[model samples]
Target: MEEKMNSGLVTSSRKKLTIVDTDVHHGYRAQSDLYPYLTKFNAERFAEWGFGGLSTHLYTSSGGLHGQRVDFDAGEAGDGLGTIGDAHYCSTRLLDANGIDLAVLTGGIAGAASALPDVDYGSALCRAFNDHSMEHWIAKDPRFRLNLDINSQDPLGAAAEIDRLGSHPAVCGVMFSCGAPKPFGQRFYHPIYEACARHGLAVTMHFGSEGEGVNPPPSAAGFPSYYIESRQLRPPAYAVHLASFIFEGVFEKFPTLKVAMVESGFAWVAPLIWKMDLDWKGLRRHTPWVKRLPSEYLVDHFRFGTQPLDEPADPEAIKHIINWIGGSRTLMFASDFPHWDADDPMMTLSDQPEDLRRRIFAENAIETYKLSLPAISQAA
Candidate 1:
């Protein structure tokens, strides 16, 4: 039997399956594109001080097309070339072409602006980007869902934004863009998490913002010089955030809150969970509020994206790692679309069992994001 997905892609199967991509990126064509969304004050400030409201210099590093795929066309035609492109490119190359049921739009500006020293300006930029994303990306396709880009610097403002757009039928989660001044589990961020739980929105902490503006160094040893070196530091950053959330008791406060670590590899998760369980056995006295083991919260409330999928020398080792991490329930397929390192859905985790593959590609996301089949299918 043939079952048609909400995205209008039909699959030869009795049961309808959804391919929920958790980490698709949609960026603006230019800084000027946000001008209309910005307030009069922020617009003038942007003209004078640029992005950070202090310096025009952005985090510079050597990488081909800023790590985007070389073959990705920016919809260039004649004189109308040199644009930054938008979600349509993703729809063309990834979503539509790959039979993706739903893809989450994780915008760049919201995360980038989170590092700015000026909290008010950073919050404004996040709001502007959310508006821009709603108008340009989410409104264009039902297959796409929004991860509300928020500024962690202003928790109150972040919560307010969540309240404003949290109920939007197209919105599924909230994104912090990683690079926050403090660990997400701290008291400072509880308000944001509280707002997310209220809206039944998952929280996605994507990789970015480290060592830029007011954000701390990427790793404990301080900043690394090369892009490769910086990429190597992402896992540890995720580990720290996970530890903070577990130890600080964020889960106990908002039991329904779900957290997804996007663009952060999953190989380190098994070890981190094992080690935390070992330490918690003895250290449980200090953080008594954490009634269960640390790993329990992780397996219950946490999820990991499968992009930049850990490629060890032994290909079979990937299977072993996935088994150790609790199978498809803990992993979601993320393509990091339009980026140079995007994974091809047909190729990712091909060796996994059919059941596991279905969960990673679709089932896990449906449960985590609390999405309905009819809603997802109708969007397509």
Candidate 2:
């Protein structure tokens, strides 16, 4: 268990841009690593039945294990079998290589915690994962900001968990996994949202746990048969949650609360909002609390991350999607690092204007999660 060592500085002088990767996945070698953080009762549960979620059992992985990076020296300098954890390895291989100023560590298995049948167990798992992250990853790197993993099943417990860890300096947001029993409106999960709003933490729904554990099927028509169909289903699912958050008055009640929809595509935002706005106009009385157009709420309170970004032959294609989703203000850059489909900073949107690229790559993330970092000056 030796840590790979490096300066941990981004060496931004080379790139002359402040890059913030909003969706970096940090993982544990095994559940045993988190045993110290878990309660004795739950520790036994974890030991008996590991990762009680069905998402992994269904999907086929690509690239390396779990579709992680295949080129990094995961164990030794000659290039090893893994690249998921080890903070210093990330510093040398990812941050320094790309000149990234900061990265938000979005816990990998956190989503499965939400999908578990037992609400109390799910919340406990989220808590243990949070504790494990605070020790292993956050304590290891200043560049690493964490989004606290929270179970959506136990709203009050999740809210209480947020109260416990929300004020931690390294915590910028919360990772609420998808595959929720209900689309995240319904006032059922308001306590969690309230706590996040109280602490200025963004509620980031990273795409995982689509059809897993006790959660519902990924789609209303039942589970999709193939991986490609599930990938395409991401945006529509997000659109449902987005609509739930808006129409159910989640945003109206918690005005300052922000959400980061991660790994879910952004192209559906336009059509969803258009239909929502049209329906609201004709049927505003059904939910009178929604005082404004859905798009207005989206513009003010939501941020979408770009990974597996749609790469049309030209970079210009993304701008249309960007404009449809309230401009670059709502777009945050996410690399989905260590995964096979991860986006490259220099390669994605390389042809865009410097300012726009800066916003999407760095500034939007900084704004979305309300992180306070010193201004970066470009190299002369």
RMSD of each: 4.0, 4.4
Clashes of each: 5, 3
lDDT, each prediction: 0.78, 0.77
Residues 95-117, model 1: lDDT tens digits = 66667778887655665677887
Candidate 1 deviant stretches above 4 angstroms: 1-17, 53-64, 76-84, 373-380
**What TM-score does each of the candidates earn?**
0.90, 0.90
The ten-residue window of minimal lDDT in model 2 covers: 74-83
lDDT per residue for candidate 2 within 222-286, as digits (tens), equals 88777677787788778878888998998878888889988775777778878988999999999
